[model samples]
Target: MTAVKVIKVVGTSEESWEAAAKEAVERASQSVEGVHGVEIDHWTAEIEDDEIVEYRATTEIAFPVQD
Candidate 1:
């Protein structure tokens, strides 16, 4: 039998939302093995001086459970 797990992780970057999302998956993989996929839930940005300073992404990461 096989099982999977899903977890929510937030990533931030000075670049774009895409980069933030990718960072979430990559960071998760560093700690949890068998990282399979990521689903972006939403995007947000930080503004400073009326300028976008940072991009944030809320993502769901999926991985297979290890025995």
Candidate 2:
């Protein structure tokens, strides 16, 4: 049998929401191994002076557990 665990994380970027989502996984993978999949939970943005300044993404990362 295999064991899997999930973690919630947030990533922000000045580019796009897709990039933010990808960044979340990329940053998480730096500390987490055996990453299998990612689930995008939510998306939001920050606006400043009638312009969108930042993009944010919330994601859940799934990875395998080693015994």
Candidate 3:
């Protein structure tokens, strides 16, 4: 039997949402192990002076529970 857990993480990038998501996963992986998958949950952006300043991505990361 195996158990999995889900965690929500938010990452930001001036480049793209994909980069933001990847950043979140990479940052999480630094301290976490056994990562199974990452699911993009939602996306939002910050606007400054009617222009997009930054992109933010919210992701759900699934990983195996460590014993």
Q: Pick the candidate with the highest lDDT.
A: 2
lDDT of 2 by residue, 2-57 (tens): 89999999999999999999999999999999898999999999999999899999
State the displacement of the C-alpha of residue 38, model 2, in Å, after optimal TM-score superposition. 0.3
What's the true lDDT of residue 31 in model 3?
76
Pick out the ten consecutive residues of candidate 1 with the lowest summed lDDT.
Answer: 21-30
What residue runs in model 2 are displaced by over 4 Å at the alpha carbon? none
The better-scoring model by lDDT among 1 and 3 is 1
Cα-based lDDT at residue 60, candidate 3: 92
Window of ten residues with lowest summed lDDT in model 3: 27-36
| Per-residue lDDT over 1-67 for candidate 1, one digit per residue giving the tens place of the 0 to 100 score | 7799999999999989999998999899889999988889999999999998999999999999989
Candidate RMSDs in order = 0.9, 0.7, 0.7
Which residue pairs of candidate 3 clash? Answer: none
**Span of 10 residues, lowest total lDDT, candidate 2:** 58-67
The alpha-carbon lDDT assigned to residue 28 of candidate 1 equals: 90
**Candidate 2 at 10: error in angstroms?**
0.5
- Score every model by TM-score: 0.93, 0.94, 0.94
In candidate 2, the residue pairs with backbone N, CA or C atoms under 3 Å apart (3 or more residues apart, or in different chains) clash, namely none
Better of 1 and 2 by lDDT: 2
